[model samples]
Target: MTGLGDSRHVVVVGASLAGTRTAQNLRALGHTGPITLIGAEAELPYDRPPLSKDLLVSDWSDETVEGFRLATSAELDDLNLDLRLGVAATALDPDTRQVTLADGASVDYDVLVIATGAAARPSPWRPASGLLQLRTLSDARAIAARLALREPVVVVGGGFIGTEIAAAAIKLGCPVTVVDPVAEPMTRIVGPEVAGSLVDLHRANGAATRFGVGVVDIRGEAGALTVVLDDGSELTASTAIVGIGSVPGTAWLEGSGLTLDNGVVTDARLRAIGVDDIYAIGDVARWPHPGLGAHRAEHWTNSSDQARFVAAAIAQDAVLEYSSTDYVWSDQYDWKVHTVGWRDPQGSSVLVGDLAADGRVAVVHADADGNACGAVTINWVRALNQARRLLMAGDTAEAIAEQLEQLTVRAA
Candidate 1:
């Protein structure tokens, strides 16, 4: 495999984890290209998971959210790659191989990597002032300031981000209430049984869980928010944090001719189907998985891994078939919950280990053939490691259970 065409002009969008990793890999793979890193955010690329966890509770300053730079100023200076920050790509012309920026600048690319991650989905009903969505560093900083006041916080949506924010608010000694339309929290992701555990945990922590309730409207400024539920009940709070979900940042690709279902459709190689010389990765990419079949994973592990795979492919190497180890973790209430592989809802769900009061729990999702479709462990590091190993070895759930029993005995 030789360098496809002149690999001199490489353009990457988004500057998020996936974009940064892809840039790093492009250089590391011996591609002598003038890489251009473009980002819409004013600040340098930063980590996001901590924004909902430690940043909310800790006294971390706003400037601390600069994030881990894949290539520092010195490194970037040495590499001499063009760095364009706070500018959005407005359009893409595949025929001309050019990207038009919002500033009316055109960047021609020999090869383009689309890593324009997703933005937090805005609430349908706008607040009197404005609803809050924690996606960027600025968003996180503002939320942290509100939580520091130790005032009543109302969080809409029970997804991982919302739950983590709610738990962080509780830890910050603020009155917290979570309102979700679902009959149970996290029912859409982990089903009723797992959701039940979360329900109990939230209650035990003294956080109000208003299940089956939907927020019809939010009124008032950032200092005071009035939340009207679907049942016509109203609750006033000092702050309202909305984390319904996220949508792909692909509005710029409206007429790109590349498929965009929930996100940019890609094959297993993370290459956009029907589009040549372009690749998409991260939260905005929906690619087929070998183990989970055709599915788009919005996990951090998936983003970074996909970036590496795409980078190798870009370098024209004899690329290995893309497959995921399927790792994702969330932090809340002193518990570290990790999941490897997609949870097969139709498969059998089993609680293999007791979490006890300390928030240690392990559960496995098995297919009809007893293969491990997914595994989730709360505050159980050993269980997470074993699950990851089984996923890599392609072991079935029944075999994993047998191995888990031995682990329990050893712990005993």
Candidate 2:
């Protein structure tokens, strides 16, 4: 209502990494306003990246959620935020500046932040049992338990999340099969050159591939489920993970007068278009990029960066437009894959190191005009760091490749 330490009530929907981090950054930026942190899950805000990796591969307990929590009960108390866990924001009235919770109550807010993130796109084929999609801690726990049985696992996508889950299941000694309709699913993101290596990596690690076909229907239940492929083939598995994709968590905002296409469309500053006193971040927000046009990035780094930017604007009236590093990473078996920026198919790419001959490698990508735009590194941290710097600095693709090659030589 007043200034940073005033009595303004800031209600943040979606207690996710983005929501929690926004709250944290607001406090760190000296916003003493009453912040209401709402979440649909009862669990404390924990990191979701591990839901498909560490959480499934390793043995963990219900309490393991706390180990990955972004903040604890004590920390929330220290920040003096009103904790509204296990209840979702069912309705939002931007005109009235009020949030209607599922608990039949309403809270007035001077400012509202939407960071609900996303939910795994629901599987069209739902059997009586044995179908799972990893998007939350509970989902991860259930999936971990299923994989622990060391039975067959059919991951219904070859994208990063699905592949990561498949890797986890394979590591647990489960016979795994990755099913995808898009033959080379990663071609759009990582290009065909790298996608081939990824396919090899999966085969090298003992994960089966059923690409170029999709599951038309699934029958039976866990431990006896039958995956019916569109090509009239069938694969029996103990469990099936449908990681085809995800949808932005915007169902609750349907009648809230907010524009939602793929997500909450925002301006350059991430403020919800056509509304004042409201902002959207994380997977739920699709903001414009100076170079890449408008799109939503589900990467963890984007969430962190957007949260801090929005908090600074609210706390200090900051004017700098938000710019993302566009960074992402994944762990499949023993490989550590890191990607910086987007890969342009129309542009050219330069391979710096040999992944087969060498243990690590880097692929530098350039735009049509030869400006370095992106890089992908496998098990090579130094190359990743250098790639990030060079790409961010707008180095030529050739320049990036040369420098990475020099670094490779030095390491050798």
Candidate 3:
């Protein structure tokens, strides 16, 4: 394996949050090596969470939503970091440590960080222009234009992205309907108990929630879109947004000989499992999670934490293991949802607080032997943090409930 750190060429692909942070941390670690940031998007790296929230509310200006621009043209000039935008990587030759761009140009690097991230998976059932996918700033901008028409909008997929966009459309005074195959939104992530609360949240906000249904087909004509559901129901609107899911952007690494499953397979250290001097992070990484004890591809906290860990490892020239705290956060309507660790409701679960009646609540998931597996919190950041610490301490369901009760008593 080639040594990293001093005078090495570190190339990071995908200029999203993870890629940008990797570059920033590399500099912070005092690595004087040449750094190159490559991105397929035309615009600079920006925050994606806000695209569904603030951008839809019309509160965020165009420039403000462009997210955190780590380095500007002048900043790049001063730092002498090569910032390549609007160029798609065509292939990767791990043996040669060379990245081939679409323009037939190749860049060699001593150390490579594959932060290619993930792309919005296009709907297989929809026509070329029948559905709109949300991922990039351009996608958001296009959807915004459609929402401005104030016509009825149907959002496919009831996950966080779909629900958030639906709420935003509701705020815009547009009649919005959400369709999903699952019985409740966010069931896969937060489980039915927590996801059911979200159903009520959307309903309370005057957005129609159609669960246990899927958009079988989409047909568009004359500047209008029609979405057909599995149950013979049809929804027509001027615009339709599809939030199905995303696939890892590792197409260029097809013949790289590095492990690739849902994402580029990497060890806990974020290094490609079988290749030296090659690493993967962000949404494009599939690593065995510390809490889950299984390989998973997560989009948010995983990326951030892995970037920091990999940066330090590259700088120190040592193999460092990355263990996730398994933290993921989401904002829906007036509720702030935070999840920590991995939770299975089939396991022992204690209703830490009153959830049936609502207000705010917390649910702690425990394993068969009573060890805390994870927790789901609604609008309860303080309690969530408490749960996180308690889980890390190997607390049980009863213990966590006691802690929650103590928190409630203190709040009173």
Query: Clashes in each model (backbone N, CA, C under 3 Å)?
Result: 2, 1, 0
Per-residue lDDT of candidate 2, residues 1-412 (tens digit): 4446756788899998999999999999989878999999998889999888877776596576577888888998888889899998999988889899999989899888999999999999989999999899889989988988999999998999999998889888899999999888767777776788888889999999998998999889989999999999999999988998999999999998998999999988899998868999999999997657788899899999999998888888887778989899988788998999888778989998988889888888887777788988889999999999988787888988999999978877
Question: lDDT at 91 for candidate 1?
Answer: 91
In model 1, how large is the Cα lDDT of residue 391?
A: 66
Q: lDDT of each structure?
A: 0.80, 0.89, 0.81
Query: After superposition, which runs of candidate 1 have C-alpha atoms over 4 Å from their true positions?
Result: 1-6, 66-71, 291-293, 357-359
Q: Which one is best on TM-score?
A: 2
By lDDT, the better pick of 1 and 3 is: 3
- TM-score list, all predictions: 0.94, 0.97, 0.94
- Model 3 gets an lDDT of 0.81
Higher-scoring candidate on lDDT, 2 or 3: 2
lDDT tens string, model 3, 228-265? 88999888877778888889898988988888998898
